[model samples]
Target: MTSIKPGRAPSFLGGIGSAFAVIFGIFWTAMAFSITRHSPFGGVSIIFPLFGILFIIMGVVNAVYNFRQATQKNRYSVLDITDSETEPDPLNERFGPIIEGHVFETHQGDVEFEAHDDGTRDNRRPRFCPYCGDDLGEDFRFCPSCGKRLPE
Candidate 1:
């Protein structure tokens, strides 16, 4: 829908999935809830709802994670890419090859996708550059982060 800024990570989805997990989980659990007291799992009578809530929380967490990833910032190219260039075909581009932002990935996947997202509250601030995990300094011109030159 929107252009992804190069050198950026997708938006951090915060507590978004929490809503979904709670909703669907509740729905499924709710069905069992009514039947529990009437059915087999009704010994305590409220356990069904308790589990439902847990599921809902799970769903919400899942959704938030997904959304966060989708919205996360992306590697920003130096030039503007028209829809025609990217839409018709990704490989075909008017601007010559451009360097995108850096990515700090792990075995699981990228944690600090963009250089700026590095923060204590947001992420653990991996020992390496947030974008590339490479060693760098505060004054380094290129991204010790990803070895890419910082935009002027």
Candidate 2:
């Protein structure tokens, strides 16, 4: 079975702009036609009808653009989309510890984990540093490998 993810909603401003453009376009076109047909006004300029046509074209363009934008998947990640290293792995534990002076490959780069006297073992290790993939302890306040401050 295929699961289709929900797409982002259309922009409010785009929708509103399209609606107003179409409505005003229709209104102006109608007025232009009326004036050309010898309405109460003596004579009407051609700019009104030209503007109405332009607005109608603009409305159609806006609607199409908004529809395409709405159907596209919105990704906010700063990393490259093709970079699999930074992709989320739900199966892997968030924290994995490595022995001090041990080097491991990571999405960021070769990271060396720091060893602590906290009895951290293979199954009970932190996965990587939250800021970068370095060895971190559960009780760590700062990453000794990268020198980044860690959360308490």
Task: Give the candidate number with the greatest TM-score.
Answer: 2
User: Candidate 2: RMSD over Cα atoms?
Assistant: 13.9
What value of lDDT does candidate 2 attain over all alpha carbons? Answer: 0.59
Task: List, in order, the clash count of every candidate structure.
Answer: 30, 7
Highest lDDT: which candidate? 2
Q: Which stretches of candidate 1 lie over 4 Å from their true place?
A: 1-23, 38-43, 74-152
Span of 10 residues, lowest total lDDT, candidate 2: 75-84
TM per candidate comes to 0.31, 0.38
Error in Å for residue 86 of model 1:
36
Residue-wise C-alpha lDDT for candidate 1, range 1-152, written one tens digit per residue:
24434321322333444564566686878787766766654465686667887787667666666555556555333455333323343342333222243432333233434344333233333344433447765566677544755422
Each model's lDDT comes to 0.50, 0.59
Question: Model 2: what TM-score?
Answer: 0.38
